[model samples]
Target chain A: MTAWITYVVTAAGLTLVALIRPFLGRQNELFGVVFGTRNIRQDQVGRSLKQQYLIETLSLAVLVWGGLALMAWWHQQPPYLALGMIAFLLAALAATANAHRLSSQYHQQLAVPEAMRVSVDLTQLANEQTLSPVWGMVLLPLVGVGFALPWSAVAWANLTVGLVVGGTFLLTRHLAANVHGLAAAPGAAQARNILLSFLLAVAVVAQGFGLACAWQPAQAGLFSLVFGLLTLLGLLLLLITWLQVTRRQAPAGAVRTDNARWYWGVFYYAPNDSSLFVTKRIGVGLTLNYAHPASWFLLLGVVAVVATIAVLSN
Target chain B: MELTVDFASTVPIYTQIRNAVIQAIADGRLKSSEVLPSVRALGSALGVNYHTVNKAYTQLADEGFITMRRGLGAMVAEQLPAVDPHFEAEVVPQMKALFTEAKVRTVDRQTLVALIDQVYDEGWHH
Candidate 1:
């Protein structure tokens, strides 16, 4: 793969990962609460699932490039390239399997509430039991295609657009009125921060300038500069909002200081250092964990951009 | 990570964790050989019991969804037989129960189909 393709793939992959990492965490957290919380229900679970699928597609944006890098390094031996691709497949398979198992453990405990199958419910659960084994089977073809692409700038752009659009759209739904009511509450600061984060996500993608590097244009450079700067600003906005309202702040609305808030439909269990052990430590009370996937992804983006600019200037 | 289960819901907690992890892996957040937190850590993180987390991990291991070693911790497992134990063991029976329950209530097949269709559409997304 050309250097630019690799960079583009890295960029797309990073962006998608950032948006998706927390979502998966949130989803699993919900799964964990499925049985005990007769009170919890995600009105947006299907939207979240579709969003996950889209982000997964975008992650494949880099796979093709990685495969090409392998081929380039060992072009004389197709076998070596094939081996590298196989390893990638195996690893992805393992990860995907584990994810489903996590979902299924929750599924068995799921009562399929009388209300869940309503027109507004999740279809992914339609085949809940049959879904587990089918998951790995479904991912196989995508894994193959990921190995097939030659990994170019054009492919990178397509992947980038898909990743950004899909992720932004999903994140947007979290703010789509009802979903926010759970975590954000109506009038509180948590809601405010989440709302801002939603807009910031949209702001990042609306910039048509791509990564503001390889796609920069001389004629439209001034316009690109404004938008590119705005995109960076949006990232800063996310960081600020995350830091401000998300700290051990009490939520608002029907959820008072004494009760757990239901933001995004999933219930946020009340804090108790010594409660049922799991309830005490789990949930979204700690939104700023350093090792969170999105944290790593955001760091990746910052480092990659700085390194890319540094390399070019030198 | 071992899933801290909530057994009070319509679905089990481990299933919830499994779905979330599946989504994560497909999205590329958790890669292969990436060490998952111990079930204890996950339970503490999610605020569930350690036993609940173990149940999830063990179930996943059973279906070849993940692999576990005595001290090495749980990792994503690979390429198992294409058998959907979930669907076979759970969904089909549920569907039958729904239908049987509907029949006992004297609901027509069309109503049943409509309910299923509605769920397939907006309900699924909700």
Candidate 2:
């Protein structure tokens, strides 16, 4: 009877998540640039992998737990439950992979503001349109640090690097905040924010990895406690800084701007993950709808590390 | 000073802010030279748009509610200008309705309280 109840509860939870996924999916709507000949928004390009299988995320979670419960009940081998979990996950991931890159590209093209256009051809991809090779060249190192820093120490170096790099990127962003620049020259800001987000993600992931490693085997319990508190502090600082920079942009986009100041009010990017993908962009306008998902994974990583340590210590 | 903003409302946010500041002036809640909240400070408070508030201050300068020059932000009007005493009486109730509306769709008090608690514990505001 208890097993039946648990199964029912899991099914119910999955149903709720499936039903609610549409709304959560819309949160990313604010991202993506719009440069395609046919304008596209982040939300219009079909649902994200998570949204498409809203039920999948929930159902799989339930299945992992419920299958274990049923295995215990029926005296079945639990390893098969694990195998089933892996199978469902791999299939879901494979289905969603490489599905919407085209749509995001189109959105990025349209996102370019009208005044900032260096090139008139809306149909061109970023590479085809002549961009300042110097900008791309400069962005290479930033992107390199972002993608290559697998180890925590290399990530740590990004703190000072972030200040210098983010400051430079932010200066450009502030200057480019107007509709003229956003519409006329979309990729410059896109290029910079993408680089900044990537670099920050590298640093944050490094920080999370470091914290996880800090509490490893037989470290005094006090060490874990101190490290946990410190991790929490670092997370707070990152959040505050993120808010400050984004808030600087929010009011300009507020609908009530005096029409005279509309020139100054033309920024389109959303903070963090809502940036538009670059495929569809014309050249200008900021895209804030689709940020790399690495940050969420990093946060989850921290939680997973702490949870694992708790379970292991037990 | 408590500040608030509603993005969805039909009224412009700067106008809403101007009303808040003007109401404070009329109510004796704001004494002369009592230093109105800075644009960034109040923007965070109202959660409305900051540019709207800055615009309001600029308009108030045009209307003589306060004196402002570049780099020197608006301060309360000196020597309290002659104004209708009943002006505030007409404004307060409407302002209350606006506040209620702002609060209406916002995350409820308990949720905001929880967020505040989390901010305190996690130091997210810092």
Candidate 3:
């Protein structure tokens, strides 16, 4: 029963992230396709499309949950559970991609080309908007305590938690330092700061879960409830942040409508663009400029780290 | 200070960056001893190569408009260097070319002088 509950909670969290992603950016961008703010936000077609997308996404989530429940009823196999999880992710991605296609069709009808100009403020360049990375130091003691816990046999689990926390810390710092916000939009910076804080919270929650693993079987239910509540609160916070950010005024800087620079309506690729990281159009945080030379190195480093962790975990 | 570069312009990106910095300094938007953004930061922000920004900084330092120190980034010099023979040698030909163009365009000597005064005053006294 506890395992079933865990599966449900994890599925719900994943679905929630998928549902909220479309609203993480300015309302002008729908499923990664850029449209005029007024047209996209106020047009009847745009409204209907967004409604349709939400309905489809929710229905897909329900179907995935039903399938998972059916699989659980038929057999208590670990591989079946993994299959259910994979199905949920694939379904969510397909829905999002369909939405993107619909949005692109609408954009094509307009036939308007956006300026490719990028801008930066000299006065703001020196200011660091991200939270100090020193705050990551708070996790070290938790990790140390985790190692000292009675669950010495699960030291690998504790190390995994530490690795996740440490990895995210470095990624957040890199994003904060490298990402360039073209317009002087306070909303963008605020959204980024919120994202940074949320990641820290996630890291803390992972630590809590690791420590909870050492608890006696009788206390397991209590820990699960507490963790579930914390996860719910974090998702609520994320939703609120997205709503606030989406309602903010659109960026008044250079209109970057060059569709050729984007791949599959989301990934930004411009070989001439010097920016290593650009503010994300489809999401709340930063996305890499694949054209930058440093992006390859960063990608390689991430792959190497993940491979190392996987090997060590085994 | 805000820097803007026109990518469509025929001027080289490095030259534009150098000119912008000098113009900011002349207009007093950038004060003496003010530190500039790091080359990498400014380059990424402007969507240009860091080497381009480094070239601009090198030119500014050579011209004695800014000083680059190890670990300190580029800073506006406390005192701009006095005009040297090398600078004069570079400036006279440019001034002569401008005067020749003005003369060919039938601009009177007084009008040219007045235009120079107005520009100098606007740049320095703004």
Candidate 4:
């Protein structure tokens, strides 16, 4: 029963996030494509695309949930549960990709000759936007000590997962600090505050869960339930913040319609852009600038870390 | 001080940075001895090559607008540099070109003098 409840919570939370992801960006964006100051909701083409996106996403969600229900009845097992979760993720990605492709058809072209352009707020240089570097530096050692105090195979696995989350938290801070025009974007500060706070909460929860599982694996189900509830709360906060951000008008000269630099209305590629991370055209956070040489290194580092963790866990 | 560089501008990025800093200093937007962001940070924030910002800083230093100390980063000079003969010599041709353009455009002497006066007074008041 506990397992069933956990699966349901996880599925519901993921579905909510997927449903809201399409509308969680600047007002000028439509499915990750920039359309300048044009009102996407009022534009005929944009309205049609949005309706299509909703219909597709809802249909996929229904199919995935129906499959999960069948899997639950036929075989109430962990492997089947994992398979169902994987199917849902794949479906969500497919729906989003289709929407993105459809929206790319209307991407506006600007007269600017550059493939990508960056704007910086000179006055905001002194302001500290991300969490302090000291926290990121200290997190790993503290978590390591916690893992060592009660050593077990479960502890080792928990340690691996904790390290991954901790590394992501640190990387997020780095990207947040490097984002161009983060300080100048309207409603960006509020959105960033919400995101950073949620990440900090998740990091803390991860550490606590790791230690809890190490000490008492029997209560893992209870901890999973608590984690799911917190996740749901976080996603709700994110959705509310997204709505507020998407409602605010983009300031004059703020919207860069550099659709040429973005392939498939998602991946950013501009060789002349020296930034490793730029503010996302489609989402609230930063996206990788694939043209930067260092981005490849960063990607490799993440892959290496995940691979190491996988090998260690086994 | 808000510095903006347009990619479409005919002026090079480094020159734009140099001009913006000079203008900010003239208008008192950049106070004396104020520290500036490191070249790498500015370059990253602007999504430009670090060397571009380094060149701007080097020119600013050469022009006596800012001081750069190794490892300490750039700082606005404690005292604004006086206009040297070399600087005046460089400005002469530019001014002459503008004056000739104004003449060709049929701008009257009084209007031209008033425009110059307005521009000169605008910087000091800041």
Report the C-alpha lDDT of model 1 over A62-180, residue by residue, as the tens digit. 56446656665576432233344455445434433444344434445564332121011112111111112122232233223333555344245434434443443333221211111
TM-score per model for chain B alone?
A: 0.58, 0.55, 0.91, 0.90
Tens digits of per-residue lDDT, candidate 3, B17-105, equal: 88888888888888899888877667756656678889999999999999999987888999987889979998999999999999999
For model 4, report DockQ.
0.33
Q: What is the DockQ of each candidate?
A: 0.02, 0.01, 0.40, 0.33
For model 4, how does the per-residue alpha-carbon lDDT over A1-314 read when each residue is reduced to its tens digit? 75676677767777877776666666556776666555575777777887887788778877887677776677755425566678988887787678777787566333222223455655565353646645554446546667578556545655655565555555455243222343334655456556666666666676667677667789988987788678768867876775586456554554445566776556789786655666566555557889877788878877887688678768
Q: What is the lDDT of candidate 4?
A: 0.68
lDDT of 4 by residue, B3-119 (tens): 777777788999999988888888888889887876766776566777899999999998899999997778899988898997999899999999999999999899999999999
Q: Is the docking of candidate 1 incorrect, acceptable, medium or high quality?
A: incorrect
**Cα lDDT of model 2 by residue, A143-206, tens digit:** 3554465544434433434444444343233222222211223333343354344444444444
Higher-lDDT candidate among 2 and 3? Answer: 3
Top of the candidates by TM-score? 3
Decoy 4 TM-score against native: 0.74
lDDT of 3 by residue, A63-83 (tens): 887776876777864325556
lDDT for each candidate structure: 0.42, 0.42, 0.70, 0.68
Candidate 4 predicts chain B with a TM-score of 0.90
